[model samples]
Target: MPSDLLAPALPTAQLPAHLVASSTRYVETGLRGAANTVRAYAGDWKRFTSWCALHRLESLPAPVEALAGFLTELADAGKKVATIQRHAAAIAKAHALAGHDSPTADKKVKVLLKGIAREKKTRIKQAAAFTLASFKRTIRSIDVSTPTGLRNRALLLLGFTGAFRRSELEALNIEDLAFDEEGLVVSLDKSKTNQLGQAEEKAIFYSPDPALCPIRSLQAWLRVLDRTEGCVFVSLRKHQHLTTRRMTTKYINLIVQQYLGAPYTAHSLRASFVTVSKLHGADDSKVMNQTKHKTSAMIRRYTRLDNVRQHNAAKELGL
Candidate 1:
């Protein structure tokens, strides 16, 4: 086995009895949430600790006023409201774990939650999405003969077909992709819902049309890359084997920017999928199921009015 393929051994450490019990409960109750959420929480806590140390605070068991002061400092430093809220949540969770009732928890939660609501309202102010014709034109503008073009085509197709978020696209592995006579099946262990709502594991299948240009391009790229053993996508290296190194969300964003120009991103592919699917008369329920969305409210954001209007206009004019 390659050195990179070897799984690292678990570390030996004396953990608190409550921590051990918490781990056991998480495993037994099947409440082991997304690893990304846990990592984010850990990062937020570390930032809080750093802030506390800078202020010469002895312990996190400090008064609620201290936490509020820290938040004020963050605000004064020009941190976004969302970032401040994340910091507050992290500090509250840590205080709760330490058997201290956080004095600022409720206030911080309210402020942060309001900021989130406002952000959603801001997104609603943006113009509606483009039509299928525009989307097709965008894809046709790319030259699919080169290796980078081939990879971008596959990335765009899979992202649109799966309605995948940037993180979900990055986490995809070769073993997770299953090809059948019907079409392609993508099994994802983690997604935005898993990270945010802590829901059950779910996967989505994309049945690409044989005649579709993007699908054909993806099929050709797969054959040329010959990466059937590991991750479906990889860096532009000559190695045939898939190493443990995985693509990051940052890389996916960079790829999208390089190929499609500004304002278009990995997320735009997902938006295009939802917009196009809805324009074709796909019901809200069916679209939600394919997108693996838990709620119609969340799915509605993808189905924009401009897409529907353009599609209807085309049909009415027989264009």
Candidate 2:
């Protein structure tokens, strides 16, 4: 076997070869997680290290006071509570990987985090939900005569009906789709909740209106795609040309915002599904069946029944 295939040289050259190999395997295991999550952690750690370098403080074995100070600086700079917590987690993970005790584990650091949250009074902003009527209206405005319109229509309809995370839509491939008499089934090999690559499926039925049907729209787009394999959604250039480059999650958000406009994100597709389903009297279990939500609580969270008149019992009550 080539030496290149072997683990990188470690200080354990003086020890047994098996022990060194074991250590290398363990290190690899430490790095394993959802790709986006791992990247976020790395980015957080880099930010912390740069801050430490500016302050001439040791980053690897960060002192509790130093960690607390860094978190306070973040809060002072208007970072969200979740962002600060994630940064603290990243710092703690880096210290643990380097065989140093994490300062984030200290009582003082914990108290500082609580204080920051209380002082900031911050709450994570949720994506705005669009109504089914609005979605249908916007989708109808797209000119399907152009390749861009066909792709966008299919993308939006399928994304909303599937209740897919932006990442799931981006990762979708042609082979993952299965169509039959009833409707369409999208087989996901992996997703945000199913990072273990377990096979999960979402069912989509045909809408009575062909123009509004996800299944019909997808089929029409597939016909234009003219190939049996590769990414289901790819970039379309000017003058009806298409590129094989898979769409990114960021581009997905832009596509959604382009049509829906203002405060709406790609996440709005998923949220709208939950909201619409709940309005139509679909129970949590039925919604979860389509959304693959691990719990009923998440289904409730995704619902946007903010209108006082919507789903209220006060109107039905006898005075």
Candidate 3:
């Protein structure tokens, strides 16, 4: 029996193992755009397929009413509105991949989602901005002498200054870093925004303070790694044996949580970069340059709280 555990979970019951492996790679790399996205979509799709299988319903050629029923069931089961919506999108994508129009486009499914949204009053809970004061406190708190401390410090500094997504930080390797007279340049050939694999260069300028400088921190961490290749952030074993294995992005979140407690995500570093920059009066273009945001809307989303306070018309009004 062919393993259904592989991604794409397509038919290959009688096929050779090599052929199945090749097909899975094609589906993962070609059919799917990014690894993280593929994983999320696959999981969502799996939920749908499982539900369908349990009910003895046709999954691939699923009826519009069946999708509506699925949403109803999910809502009844108290799933988050956002999660249900993501599953719906996954179903749509799956249908598209299979060369069929998604039933999610039907007015029945659309109306059901709108009703659920209205009832739930759901909102995406964003990670709290890791403020500058908090940044300073974290630096003072964390021991920077050890190899692990240096690595963590470097990760936090670069993650904030680069405004890097968790995946972007995890995907980084020592070779991706380049230094020059100016400062350091961290190259990201492909990001969540630029999945075409186009090389995008984000410059990290030298900070006045030696403690907060990303370049210096990175250099300190590199001295510990002492290798020309492999991931920049790796699992540290005894004797500083940095494994070639890459650290999961979730590690970023746990590190922050260790310092700040609950309600902070790995994205807090990136969000902090935007909020701090905005508070310092940096313009949209400068912020976007580092963040690599395609539109002003996304940058605005990250800086929304600061924008409201900084640009308040009530400040000019007389009492």
Q: Candidate 2: where is the Cα deviation over 4 Å?
A: 1-31, 96-101
Error of 3 at 153 (Å): 0.5
Instruction: Score candidate 1 by lDDT.
Output: 0.62
| Ranking of predictions according to TM-score | 2, 3, 1
Q: Write the per-residue lDDT of candidate 3 for residues 1-319, one digit (tens) a residue.
A: 0123235655888878889978766664555557787778888888888888988887886898778878899999999988899889888878766646789999888999999989999886677886688788887677887888898888888888899999998999888999998999989989987887988988998888888888998999998888998789887789766676788988777987877678787898899899889878899899999999988889989874634565576877988
Candidate 3 residue runs with Cα over 4 Å from true position: 1-31, 238-241, 304-311, 316-319
TM-score: the better of candidates 1 and 3: 3
lDDT per model, in order? 0.62, 0.87, 0.83
The RMSD of every model to the true structure, in order and in angstroms, is 7.5, 4.2, 4.9
Top candidate on TM-score is 2
Candidate 2 vs candidate 3: the TM-score winner is 2
lDDT of 3 at 301: 91
lDDT accuracy of residue 223 in candidate 1: 78
Q: Give the per-residue lDDT of model 2 (tens digit) for 1-319.
A: 1112224334786879778878866664444456677678888888888899999998867888789889999998989999999999877766655656789999999999999989888876789888888899998998998778889999999999999999999999999999999999999998878877888999999999989999999999999999999999999777779999999999999999999997899999999999999999999999999899989999988999889898898977999
Better of 1 and 3 by lDDT: 3
